[model samples]
Target: MGGTRVRTRYGRFGGALAAVVAVLATLAPVSPPAHAAPAPSVAPDPFFTYAGSTPLRELAPGTVLKTRTLPYRVAGVPLPLRVVQIVFRTTDQQGRAVAGVTSVIKPLTGTTSRVISYQSFYDSLDPEHGPSRAIAGSTAPGAMAAHVETVLMAAFLLRGYAIVMADTEGPTADFAAGPEYGRVTLDSIRAALRTPATGIAPAAKVGLVGYSGGAIATNWAAVLAPSYAPDVDRRLVGAAEGGVLVRPAANLRYVDGSRIWAGVIPMAVVGVARGFGIDLMPYLSDEGRRIYARLEKAPIIEVLGAYPGLTWADLTQPAYADPASIPAFVRTVNQLNLGTRPNPTVPMFIGQGTGGQLEGTRGDRPGLGKGDGVMLAGDVRSLARKYCAGGVDVVHREYPLSHFTSVPLWLPDAIAWLGARFAGRPAPDNCASIPAGNPLTPLAPAR
Candidate 1:
């Protein structure tokens, strides 16, 4: 609650063998809904746009309700036949039936039957920000994130791997909602493998990859697979996530009063509230309400560096001097903590950036040792160790670069790691090599 805006650090590349190298500064960048093709000759998103009473609620989770052919765009223009969209029935975090979307991108050439799930880190509260809508829809604020993600996805495509992009945040766009993210992702993969029109094998190898916001979905899906989605889990080879936010509560402390990434605090607050039907207004000060209203529909680009030195003291009422002490906030954040969840069944490849001090501010926060601008690096290490202790095969890498700068360094590795998982070879683990990390402490049952 008293986080200070301190200097950031540098990170990325060759973790175990080398120290994190400080990278230079550059602040900066960060859904799905489908619209009709402008080309009069093309049809609308038939399945995604259809108004039918199929009773998605009655169907089992992961059931494919409808299918449609949507334009797979490179930037904003359409590239027909490359991507297929599916509307499926899935369950939410609370076990309620909900409808979700997933996009299946067929490769242009090459011959790998492997299919990979690329969870794009499009962190936003707007429904249009989902990958399903952004991949083919017109360019807007948050939709361009799909375009940026396409660069990494192209590598998998060129390697002949069909990619499945799920709206992990769900149709409701519940940002930071962990269980919902897992449910949507696993179910989307289920929809893709089961949908015959996509031409994917029902038993194809699968892997999950995500960074930053996307990592929330990827990590949860992996941890939830063994129990929540065993059918999908059996086929998953491994999961790779970078710049992961393992503990949301830890992250809140990590980002408070920061320079570039402090803006995410309000964005996360509104998201968790919308997802769980909680009212944060009661504890928030007038400034907090203003920040909430301003960021209600704003995208990641708007959230980055939006607020400089914005502390909880500035947003919440004097009575709520420590937001975590608020019962509802503590309970909800604990539910979102990845460390509280079970270990992943499949092998894992994790990369963390420990250069937040150089990236923006508040890197020297006492409890939040280091970070990658938006996520806490120490928390990532703790989660990785937790997985290893649970008998999971884990490979954790720490990058010595800031959040934005670490992208190029770990993305290619994530791709290659996923590739290895699909190759039928054994994975290497670093369980014995990892050092002890800070405990992932959850709020006590009572204050």
Candidate 2:
């Protein structure tokens, strides 16, 4: 939170990725409502009317319509900066908003691209646990928003694209975890369309970009889109996810030992434990519980460095000591098998950190024979091929960057590809033909 305000509103609670599960469980009341209560309006969003423009506007080229608030609601509090909408006027060799570009690009090929949003969560030490949603940046004034404005939104706006960042923590202030991400992402996109400024062609192409926790929303959206938003006229062109942090159990184990991941463990443990009504403080020595709570919302790397000699077994309770009452809770954890799911109707960009693997970390687990760190990029691609057997566009790209870098590098390309598909470009067999297990290496960055 101390760093420059480049953090995107989208990543306001990045630290909560570890703590959200625990926090949500503790905070959400029994029989809580589906959505969070509404928030009161505070300062007027500047982008609400840029240059006297609407949410959907014709702005001067290169003039970023800054800090436009997408109408969003969180339980009881109307977060002033839930989703940041930035509009870039397309330009030529010389910067210009490229008037009439909308019309020229219009009739939008009648292709539909709906949003498939994913949310990140702390690993479930217990398979029966639900995810946490402590709203990391939400409680911290301006911290959450700065992340979105500086990191995520600016990236998209600079590229002449519009961005919708969702504060998916929802109404109860209990983090709904993965499922909520997909719901909120899809809903937010719909909200964007309905917003006065979005002016998205009714059938405009929609693409998803998320990393770490975001991958949860993106992944679920891809799988659920066909069934959920079928009537929206979407082509479901593509999705790109990096540092997936899939296989919740395994991921939990991987980071437990590492100093890098240790900082956020308390938060993750509390989040996951809360789902099962398991409070870690009761289980651990008072000193341990206090240490865990203090480190709960911090980053993982910081955790491990602080407490040396930690392991997965030490942090988590025995699996299945008590059976789960809720079917959703069981499914969220035990059923989090990534390889079995099929690909969407479009191409996919899956990335992994050199140190991270589907098995959760760089170690070897029995069923996950491939070294834990072995990238799942290949596995996801293969799954896509099988699902789209007759025909599907599945491309796998692996970057040299670790989990964090993967998203930003491939995001623009994925968007461009989605744009081409929306423009009536054919889905490619080349993706299918690309050799299996080969990392879809990125093109060298332009000088």
Candidate 3:
């Protein structure tokens, strides 16, 4: 009976998803023949760099550095989308001023009074893989994820909501650096509202939405907005996210030896090392070094299933077998933990999934129980509960699905939740009934 119900829900969701894809198909240009020429260079555009003599620190966060209007294209096919791309000033994980890029897509007909800051889950270690590059027609291997996400953006755009797609990974493509993702997202909103030509009014209300890699940016942006960008915080109606990563340390453990998600271990190590400017070369084994070199610029798609049954022991020296033994890693993951951050002031809708076995991941792993293959369900529940305890309105839902399979189910509900926030409806909460999960304690250094 349970399986029957699950299938029924997915069957309905499939129909809805098909409708969305149909709309996207109509808007997008037909693909070229199989004999078409190879894709263009995937190099980062020169406009991403700030060449101005004025220092980045001198400019305010979200200060527009450059702007250009272009037709939005997906997978190298031009669509009728008039997108405004902006290079704005934002800070990195180290709080150093840096240039960030965002693409603003206005509805064809609307008041532009409401905006959806849609952070793309373009999880990559290469700057060339950002959404701006994909929207500008780059068909890089990593940019394919961004291209596919256009359907979600189209859903909101069809509802007459302006969409602000920021390169949440920042200019350096710091894959899992949560704080940096948050700041970049907040600054993107600032840049969008400040840019008159984008048609987003200064007083426009904003809502945050994303899943997976995007959830990292969305949740971080929500928590950091009150302090990092109070001006932007006041404009936020709510945040809706799913498959969130609450504690990086916990997630590393959760996916350490999984069949599909194990590769993320190395990719994350590389990302954190790059984001924090930490040199971990001395601690890596020869095998680890090789994996690092190969995945230095890989996208999440490339890493998924590429290294099956990979483990931390395979990547680190015997002495540093435990990730906590590495001081720099301990510090980095602790800093990236969303549980340590302040609760978002606005209402939030959080979704998580538990059924890793569906994705070839074992559910039993000591402290960690079931998860959606990558992100731990307990960690997400704990984070949501913490927010609720802090007097934040939070609606948390757990699904009996894997990370990838849960998206179709979570997205429609998330979109509907955001729609309610925009409609001035009262935000709901399941905080009181949420089950107890893991303790979000910080990682302790190895003695």
TM-score of each: 0.88, 0.56, 0.91
Q: In terms of TM-score, how similar is model 3 to the real structure?
A: 0.91
Model 2: lowest-lDDT 10 consecutive positions: 99-108
Model 1 off-target regions past 4 Å?
Answer: 1-51, 110-112, 445-447
Summarize candidate 1's per-residue lDDT along 243-344 as a digit string, tens digits.
898888878878888887787888889999988878899999999998898778667777776687888788899988787668999889989888777888
Candidate numbers, best TM-score first, in rank order: 3, 1, 2
**Of the candidates numbered 1 and 3, which has the greater lDDT value?**
3
* lDDT score at residue 231, model 3, on the 0-100 scale: 97
Name the candidate that leads on lDDT: 3
Estimate the overall C-alpha local distance difference test score of candidate 2: 0.41
Go through the candidates in order and give each one's C-alpha lDDT: 0.77, 0.41, 0.87
Candidate 1 vs candidate 2, lDDT winner: 1
Two-way TM-score contest, 1 vs 3, winner: 3
